[model samples]
Target: MKVIRFVLAVALLTTLGAIQALEPAPMERFFIEFKPGTGAIIEAGVRADGGQVHHHFKRADALAVSVTSRLAKRLGSDPNIVTMEPDARRYLAAKQALLTSQPLLQSDPFAEQLVPYGVELVQAPLVWDQGFEGEGITVCIIDTGLYEQHEDIDSSFVLGGHSQDPNSQWFEDGDGHGTHVAGTVSAADNDIGVIGVSPGKASLFVVKIFGEDGLWTYASDLVAAAFTCADHGADIISMSLSGSSGPGPERKAFESLYNEEGILSVAAASNGGNRQRVFPASYDSVISVAAVDESKLVADFSNQNKWVELAAPGVGVWSTVPHVSNSWLFTGGNAYQGEPMEYAPDGVVTGQLADGGMCIAAETPGDWSGMAVLCERGEVTFAEKVATVMAGNGSAAVIYNNEPGALLGTLGEEGGWIVAIGIGQQDGQAALDFLGQEATVQSSAPVPGSSYEPWGGTSMATPHVAGVAALLWSANPAWTNVQIREAMDMTAMDLGEPGRDIAYGYGLVQADAALQYLLAKSTE
Candidate 1:
């Protein structure tokens, strides 16, 4: 009877889970524009059909509203209205991922200099010695809200900020994307935490367009935010959010910001890897940035196209986030792909990996002396597994998930255990092939402080160019935005298929080189 009841409960839970998964997403919205002098009648038509106006870009004659699909079809035929474009949500191409650390690793990154490799790669330090530390230059970051109180970027945030979502505060960062981008742009030059590429007097004006959890916001919202960037007297606008294509109104806003106000804009080339045309970045007014890694190799995920203008370090790039993340892993003279166990003791352990057959046995056949036990998760408590591995004289434990996801399981309560790391099932299984190989686990709890983490994306790459722009522009405040844009292109370290190829753009953006380009141009 117990068995039958258990089966029934499992089936019921599965059904309930499926029903929850099928819940509806938010309804679709559209961006509509009216022909010249037809706004009054077109708006009336929209209201007549149950459409609710959300954003009205009065200057550009555009209205962002929620309308039924049937109503959208009907509104299209109205002669007074121009083309109606769906208000697509542009997402942050930047994401956080722990890589295998092969081409991305080094011998103790913070040994000599604590600066991120991307900062060094762009040669920001060389320019800083010349007293061009991004002073008098302001960069506007348009994304999710910024975490105002982060230790690195507190004083740098300027003019407060505006949020499209009424509920969220511009200073509140539910998703750390904006905070990470801001840190990369202008974290304080203090000696403690990670410093930015332009770690100086450069100011940041954040415009929050997306809500707390949603990693995306409407193109209309982004358009509206750009104007906010301008209203605050921004010199450089950095856009890390992007969609497949943008509406005519959206394009008009960016063009106006560039052509009229003369604000220099940098954006991430979409991470499609395909040759798809990425909007906003593809716009002639904005400089499109592609992503390369520490090795200067173009990231495979970075979109390859002629629209790409400049390249910057994007893979395994470290900067600030809202939370604490300091634990790391390395294996076999390479950076390993794994995370330290949350409750594991603070220390580093390097040992030869030995298979331990689920690691739950009260006793094991072979001695695990000074070896890291590789065990699959199941049966016993995480503490018991580690205890058993230690009983067998193992130096440490490397637990892997039994299912699909990453095994972030704890050792329950702490004991005198050595370093232990939890990796996903795939990485664990792959680790099985090399049984005798050496793997190092560095584990530490988030006790004191450490708000920085490494992330990957063209989204990460955009801010490097933006920060470099701030550095160059601050050095030469009198230069126009066009001159700043043109100088980077002219001085970029050309890579890939020669001059201005798809992958590397002109090449990896060089800060010192751009300064030289401006100086040489001045002589001419």
Candidate 2:
């Protein structure tokens, strides 16, 4: 029957013949085919250096193929028959050469140089400790779905991972966004990778709202997902996805959650290089998170203006992955597909492969050895181009903004492989400019907290707050959603010029301080 349908469809196309062939009624747009496990590419825009332009095409094969063919034909012209994607790859390779090789965490031994001053770690062996170790708290990660099997995340008591639409298979995230956010909020304190903000034990309800593909999701789905999370007993909903132009059904649904269930919602303020606010974040009931650089300055690309509730460390942070085995072994797994990923130095492999593939040490710079650079998006799209170069790679393949702007994105997997890293506009431009010159590639150890590493955007920052939020909620079961948000705001150490500046928002989230405040208030 399926074969007959295909034959009939082809026959129908043949009948339309000259008209279909000649007029070409917009071939369904072709999209970058992302390999499974990688997160969705939610946004793409212009790059720096004025060397390239980006335009998004809907995920329709006919349209995408038509656009590509046309572009290819256009490239076969005089001033150098060329395609921008390939040019971008070459440009990225050159750029990787100029980067200073250093692991993000290992750089500058001083805490001041690495960890932000705002981060005030709770001293070991507590002083008047509030017992808010998030025992019964439930955080709903409303992005991609969660991976129940991840050792770090506790699914044992996961009330349920529910979805809005019954027909929508999008409840699960093939993309890595939701899981990463979930890890931050409530990954169990299993001796695995990094711990969650709310360490110890808690519940994580995977409330998926985004599809595997598509630039923007229907507001209806978002609304349904939120209501689903609340209905499933979600105490706090941590959302890393964002979009502007709202006040739609989704906003109404979110309002209902706040009014009826008293569900607390947190959203990314967006990574778009503008002050405009994104939805959910812009919504009155939700807490909006902005990005902060190492300098404790608001990331140049992080959305600003009013509507922001707080700020967290958004620059070059790290966390857990669902397929810990695959990611740890550098198997190059794609979180979206939820499959075991294997990475051969090339496409194919020969003898016994090494456990955990070679990782481009964070912050450590090197000449890209014709490999793809993996980067997170933000700052400017050009930052992706730059990281690819500095990583000593041949191509740039960036991930989702991870902040608020656009949470899912795709690599233009047209020519060679792509290298990815999240970058801001200033750094992106600086790297691109460096690519134009003949410069020696720099090298150094990985900087643990600063330098060229995974950082920037609400995506990176959301987990930190989520972890802290978890800790606070755990310590104080009686604290309301509003109360928790208030405590986080009140206890934050101011980083910007006194009071609440946009850069640091109310200040850096101090987990221990918040715990103490909540405990003291409980006594009163």
Give the winner by TM-score: 1
Q: Per-residue CA lDDT of candidate 2, range 90-191, in tens? A: 000000111222223322211112222223242111311444556687877766565555555566746667654344443344444555566556545544
Global lDDT of model 1: 0.80
- The lDDT for every candidate, in the order shown, is 0.80, 0.48
Clashes of each: 0, 83
TM agreement with the true structure for every prediction: 0.74, 0.56
Candidate 2 regions exceeding 4 Å error are 1-100, 106-130, 164-172, 213-215, 293-295, 323-456
Error of 1 at 162 (Å): 1.7
**Residue 448, model 1: Cα distance from true site in angstroms:** 12
- Flag regions of model 1 displaced more than 4 Å: 1-28, 101-113, 325-450
As a TM-score, model 1 comes out at: 0.74
Please write out the lDDT profile of model 1 over residues 403-454, one tens digit for every residue. 6544445565556777777766777787787788886666765332336667
